[model samples]
Target: MIHLLRNLALVSIVLIAAGCDRIGAPVRVDDAWANATPAGATVAAVYMKITTKDADTLLSATTTVADHIEMHTNSEQNGMMQMRPLSNVPLEAGEPFTFAPGGAHFMLVELRQPLTAGLRFPMTLQFQHAPAQTVQVQVVELGSR
Candidate 1:
């Protein structure tokens, strides 16, 4: 009876230790910002820098202030600027993915309200490998960033 109890405790400990890795995968988000929107505007853009130790993908982002969020990239085509939507942002180990203006960014479509300068809003980010992280996105003037 004692032998069986000891084996059960060891099995439980092993299972818990294995789960800790999945629960705590390290992916870091930094320098997150959004440009403040003018009154009556329903769209805005967000920028950020992300780094990860393992290969990971940024699956989606959500905020209460926006009707929906989507990832987009800007490029020049035949002397005209074009915006394209991205399905996901994939990263390699130790490589930082940057989202910036006139480049890759998040589009906040149909905003609930204008994002005012000096305001910080909570945005939750979902990842392919690491756990979902909620980050506070700071709002700045349009030309300030």
Candidate 2:
């Protein structure tokens, strides 16, 4: 009886640990923000951390804030930072992918209008293996961060 009880307890612990992997939903966004920029002739980048519980890919994104939204990454070109567009953002289960300045980021180009503080914009993100999600992001003025 003692041995049977011990085995059952061990099995319960293993089941709980395995369940953790599937408990995380498809995708989650954290610390999403567009870098502060000047009034005119300014380009901005949005940063965030994307987490996926299952293998997925970021297909595309759309928003009215910019004429074009592209996934980009900064690479060293002759020791200088060179930004290049990515084919797609890859996500792995139980992994966090961060999009920050000087790294993997989102290029919000051709600003339709200047982004001012206290302004929030609607943006949508589409995933290859998950449903499209929309998020509201606020604009931070220069000198704010």
Candidate 3:
């Protein structure tokens, strides 16, 4: 009877540990901002720095200002800069993922309206292994970089 109880306790501990692995850790976004778009423009870019406590992947993003949002990376191909969609962005534990001009950024397409300077908006970021987080994004001028 004692051996059977020990085996049951071991199974219970294993199950509890497996369940804990499914819970997501926290992530943080900082210095999030969007570039101001000119009138009649239908697209804009957003930049930010993301940090995670555990390994995770950025699955997608959404904002009320745009009809569609996706992760993009700018690369030079054939002497021309090209922006390509990224399916997911991996985040290393305790490492910072930076999204800036001329690098990885959020491509906000089909703008609902022109993004004006000094305006702020909410952007929701979804992750594969973490809870979705919403952050405030500031709109800066074209020259702000």
lDDT of 2 by residue, 21-111 (tens): 5596567887778756686854678878888778899988888889978899999989898878898988998689998767998888898
Q: On lDDT, who's better, 1 or 2?
A: 1
lDDT by residue for model 3 (28-111), tens = 788999879988999999999999978899999999999989899999999999989999999998799999989999999899
Model 2 quality (TM-score): 0.79
lDDT of 2 at 145: 68
What range of 10 consecutive residues in model 1 has the weakest lDDT sum?
19-28
CA lDDT, candidate 1, residue 50: 90
After superposition, which runs of candidate 1 have C-alpha atoms over 4 Å from their true positions? 1-25
Clashing pairs in 3: none
Candidate 1 lDDT over residue span 6-44, tens digit each: 999999999988886665557888999998898899999
Clashes of each: 0, 0, 0
- The parts of candidate 3 lying over 4 Å away from their true place are 1-25
Q: Model 1 RMSD to the real structure?
A: 4.0
Q: For model 2, which pairs clash? A: none
Ranked by TM-score from best down, the candidates are 1, 3, 2
TM-score list, all predictions: 0.82, 0.79, 0.82
Each model's lDDT = 0.91, 0.82, 0.92
Candidate 2 has its poorest 10 consecutive residues by lDDT at 35-44
